[model samples]
Target: MLGAGAVLGLLAACSGGGSGAAPRPTSSGDGEIIVASGLDVTGSDGVRQQLIHAWNLTAEGRKHPARLLELPGGADEQRSQLLGALQSGSSQYDVVNLDGTWIPEFAEAGLITPLDPQVKADPDVIPSVAATARWKGHTYALPFNSDVGLLYYRPDYLKAAGFDPDSYPAAGMKWSGLQTMIRQLDTVHAEGALPGYQRGWTSQLAAYEGLTVNTIEAFASAGVHLTDPDGHYTADPAQLKTGLDELRDRAGSEYTLRGALSSYEAQSLSDFTAGRTAFLRHWPYAYRLLPQSLGAGQWAVAPLPGDAVLGGQDLAVSAASPRAAYALELAKFLTDPKSESCLLQAGFAATRDSAYRTPPPACPYVSPPAGSSPSASPSASSGETSTMPRDGQNRPLYASGTLRTALTSAVQRPRTPYYGAFTQALQSVVHGWLADPDPPDTDQVARRLDTALRRALAGR
Candidate 1:
């Protein structure tokens, strides 16, 4: 199978723009920064409109005056449009948003230029946010909306488990650990104290981005790094075995809390917000809907369990553009703390340190109900709550800040060219393993995986 990066790069190379020719846009323009962004505004058109409004306001007074245009259509269509934009020598759009994982592919294809030092030197921008834009030691796209998966829990349920609300493992916590906790919670829920209480954990596990990202987190925490230190796939059999075994066990276990294996099916997020799950593994965007879905105080949020990998997107400028500087300036503005907050307010998590550190009033909680004015701060302001693995209710019974610290220290998924292929192959193997009660010959599995990795790495 073709590795994700190679697939993209190959597409880029074959797209007729490999020689750095800028696509000629049917509509030519100067002075305005056209942004090709992908924020689906179909259902919540009002919210989508609000985001555009907020962005327009924040982008005003910037060094360059920008005209942000929403790029319509699906991802494949969008990708094609972006390529067409770059190849046609058209300056229709200066900035474009990319999935966080797509940064490498975009950069490798030379579709975007790296950020200039002048923008990095700006005091208004956060370095952490700026750093996310960098590709190959150069900044390409500013991190616009930043999101990391977190564990959502009910404090009431954890209290029933006899475990202190605090003291949940921050980093290095394993999915196996969650399995144990869920079993305990199920036992308590069956005791009839918590009637509506279901399984312990819920997640989107239908072979999509969420599944791949979650699996990476588990493997990373299990000490099975996806890519070698040199940023390439490794043939570490023991590491792979341990990681696969843990995943298979978790996947096969029927007692996984509701939040553990809930298929997104049709309306997973809607279902999640409806409070059908006890614990959820999801991105920060879900924060906006909790109040409406689970009711206030019923749901709580914390950083993802040990070694949870970060899943989000980044922004990049087209390298072949005539106005590279202008494109980057627009990119910088889009990822600016103020801009990030706007995106966050619009329901995405801002990747900037400032936005994350000095969260808007809605930081770590639901925003005011839909169509309501945004809050300046969280309503229930408590002291720095423990971020460690919490018992249940999002309350921090553990030491303050310990959870986030642990999570940050935990290993992240492999940032490699072959990440997609590796993950798909692993998923197949792991799924089969989970389905079979009698453990198949793991040796055969390993051989197949090893062969698959070698083939993917070789660009077959």
Candidate 2:
């Protein structure tokens, strides 16, 4: 079972028509299992490639070696490529790495096959993460890695502003408290106490899926759910107004960096690392990369205020694959407890609880010799080793505590079969309003959004 608010919204019109015909089985059994996935953010020779290589050395893999096919472009572009390939039956993708939101869409369209029942009953998977693998009472994918938004802050800046960094809340604080700290940091910046300080915080607010995610976080914080659990348009003018007000306040010009208007993950991370903002709203991966730029004790991380969105990819066997059996085994091997521990060490939010609680043995896949520099290590990202402080148990110091707390309570974006349409409608309306110098009244915006959403959900 998933935590409260962990499950995605219900059914909607399916996106991209499928052939509805079963893929022809292949007679040749010697071909490699090709895995199609989005860019490996872990840099070249990433942890994923390492794990796959490890599997290839196994007795089973010697007969059927797997090759990783990294897709180019952002999430949207990758989705289109996958859908087109799967629909046309042109590509030989035995396994596909899909964003959690795409589970309903792929499952409803029969692009991916249901996973084994044993995988569905695996209790080691996080409750919220396990829920993402299922849609309409069947499991279509297995949780690979999990994601949740986290607040990355410059503790050095807080100290310079006469605040005790040690006194900061570890459990989490409300948005109002964060605002007060931001104001103090601003005052200090004005006095030339902090260099390159432009504003309180920055986040991904571009007119893409990032904007949709940010908007949903604001709406959830205000207790405004735009859609019912069944994915029906259920928001009223008042509810929308409340949600919009919260978004506007948090993202107001006075509090946020102007560059955030066109920023995505890379841009936001750059801004934060450049010392342009004291606070940043980003995913868990940033935790590893940030240490590359900011030295030890210079910054810290905590759970984001209000609700954070759940993210991460799931591994699914392509329905058209002749090597479905091998693909299934690969998925299981990649998400097994040992692999998950390796992911955690590499800075991903592991889906298994054991990765956090249990002491990890050396990553069997890629182990560097003792006392090697980051550049000398195979797991290093962009030639930089992670300086993320770890506990005595070898887990990230924040992993079992702060990070786990956030994941347990994180919320999901609307879970509709037509998620592409739903996100497009939401981002278009929201970004338009945010971009306006003199936006219309909340009621007018609300009406426009509601109508647009209804049309999108209804597949009009």
Candidate 3:
């Protein structure tokens, strides 16, 4: 499914140089400040409710009480609906949540307004995460929780294969080193030494924006930047080939789970939760919902073998909203140190620096909202992937500096107005390479990507 990344395809990008740029419905939403967010499936609804509840207690909060406008889940549909609202000049939504990759397209289109530069810079957020809000010299959005890929592994499985479980997640490991580990675990599982573990490794590699992210991380880890120093579209074919080659290795039969072709972030987590996979590449939210059965010693969160692509959602004032001022204030409230701390402890990672440094509050997580329905994309909950996970919101996550460090070291996907098309092109070509009977001659594929990216930039 195309998403906020795909929304880039829905709009016309730059002609020459310059730019532009979920919620559930509530009865109280009418006439109140409306925040449209992709539902947090990891079940952070209580955090949302309490934040709004807390806001209403203040004098200003009562005057401009914020409520949710749940958008249809998944990137593509959410983007389409949001674009339709903004383009149609609807005043229905005051605050809008955004995927960082969609910043260029919306900014270029003038569909969202730039926010306060000071507030954008106020938080001690990870630099890369902070960068998503400031594009082309202006800050257009507020940095909410940031996502960088972490390698979640079954410590028991690794130890069974004669590997040190604790050594892996503390720092970045080489991709080649990970492959060695995967192969060892694959063999171990095959020999029935790890009975419940059915797969060696799994990740968000399906033909969607997630593939684009995974592919970009591969390239970025190898020092390939899709944009040049000036932030213009440029890619070295050889470098791209190197990255794609690594992806091909991971997609190999030995490394992939049985339903690997269909896996996204949620599915990967589900498999991991069921003890079907030994290693998982997912975001921080997974920790909140992780089964108690696995427990702390059984799993660990560490940096990906290479740097990962940054993710998570952001908040913006819709250019079409009538209450831009109110919306901005509401956004500030939600992303403020206190609210962000609440979010951090609740499962959705926080974008505020203070949230990470401070101790988590007691009982930060809340129970699932009454009558919460499952999304069409089963397991699709994270706003980073799709929405938050629906299954594991109450699960507790232990704090470590690993995730914070991952955010600092993570790479971002290409910053282009045509991110949707660029992502589609990447997903298509990479999927083709993975599906090929013969290993792809990635040099040829690189040339194709070069053409594809140029065309996307040209808005063709």
Candidate 4:
């Protein structure tokens, strides 16, 4: 029930810090927690705008507050900007917020400090965020707001396809099952009673982080291996082909529609909410906005298919910061339920397990009826009917916690120093996959991706 404005007010209060003498070049500096965040602030959905407001509200309650520097827009741009600022001779940023996936790159590059000491030392932190904060053998960042890919469904069209409103997928869990639904929905659309049946699924397939996340989830769900346990790219031709084939098939299927890949955040939401798409795969942050964005009775969330590859932001002190202990304290506090709730209330998903269990009133996405029970089962939920009984989207995985784990283990997309190149390669393939079925050379695409993954892993 917390509006965006209220959350912004809260962030502003939480970021109060005295502007004393700026610190020197060394990590050991004077008293100041110069926190720099790269959250979008100017846009309507800007997280930083809300964070600044929330920080302002929490400032009165904090024993010690930090000065927040709102990094400018552009995820990739902010990375370079913050890095330059932090590495500058007179850098003042004590705690740096980083993209969760980039933690490995940053940690290995020594751009961020190891968090093992803080993890070992801090007891009040959330377990999930704590676990992700550490990279390699040590912790590198404290996960701030966690996001996961969730499957969105419309109960209306799905039921029209003769999908069991209750046991949507109890009979089969294969992508083939969803394919049947999409094909039927397409038929129904042609009949004109339903809007021309579009693909049942929508996702960010453009060459961006959302594309990476969506493609990886499909690969993982299909049981593909892009890497080994030691984080090596598996060049196994069969495995690589299998992954690419599944991605291509999903793209070809009737239900999986090509969304506005260029701008995932705004465009995909528009497509799904406008009823142009039947199902959407996106992060949880969309849940709060979708109701308003899509209108009532238009949208609802089910547990993401197969599982989700959870992604999020992390808070870590720069290895170069002198206020390591204080920064860690602030990290621990911000992740605490009270502070996390403020962010959640404002529309961010909390990374803490505790926040998941006992969400503050502000967070609308936290209470999915499954509560915090880790082993919650989606189909096993007591016979509670969906609000829209006609929609045939996947059965709500509201309580199913195992589905999330299944997704995380399926694939860890090829990580590399030139992630930009690897992602570009993926963009090429995704475009080919979505084009009219010419049966593009799957083998060639696989080889190209395999080579790219290998090069990235090898740091070439």
For all predicted structures, in order, the TM-scores are: 0.71, 0.90, 0.83, 0.76
Instruction: Give the backbone clash total of model 3.
Output: 27
Greater lDDT among 2 and 4 belongs to 2
| Clash number for each model | 39, 1, 27, 38
Each prediction's RMSD to truth = 10.7, 8.4, 10.0, 8.3
lDDT of each: 0.52, 0.79, 0.69, 0.57
* RMSD from true fold, candidate 4: 8.3
**TM-score of predicted structure 3:** 0.83
lDDT of 2: 0.79
* Ranking of all candidate structures by their TM-score, best first: 2, 3, 4, 1
Candidate 3 lDDT tens digits, 1-460: 2243322221111001111111112222335888887876454444555565555545556677778777776887798889888899888888888888888888888988876543536646667888887778888888766777878888888899988786764465688888788788878877878777876888887888777777887787777788852247876677777777777777777677877666887788888878888888888877655643466567766778887889988888888776776667677767766666656656676776766676543332333322343522222223332222223322233333676677777788878777777788778778777767685587898888778777776678
Better candidate by lDDT, 2 or 3: 2
Model 4, span 307-339: residue lDDT tens: 466666788777767776566666655665565
Query: Where does model 3 exceed 4 Å of error?
Result: 1-30, 117-120, 229-231, 360-398
**Two-way TM-score contest, 1 vs 4, winner:** 4
Residue range 43-140, candidate 2, lDDT tens digits: 77677776676666566676878999999999999999999999887548988999999998888888998865535467888989888888888889
User: Model 4: runs farther than 4 Å from truth?
Assistant: 1-32, 40-64, 87-90, 121-129, 164-166, 169-172, 258-263, 359-421, 428-439
Candidate 1 per-residue lDDT, tens place, 145-231, comes to 655567767655666677655555234556667677777877877777667655556666665455666677767666677565334
Error of 4 at 292 (Å): 0.9
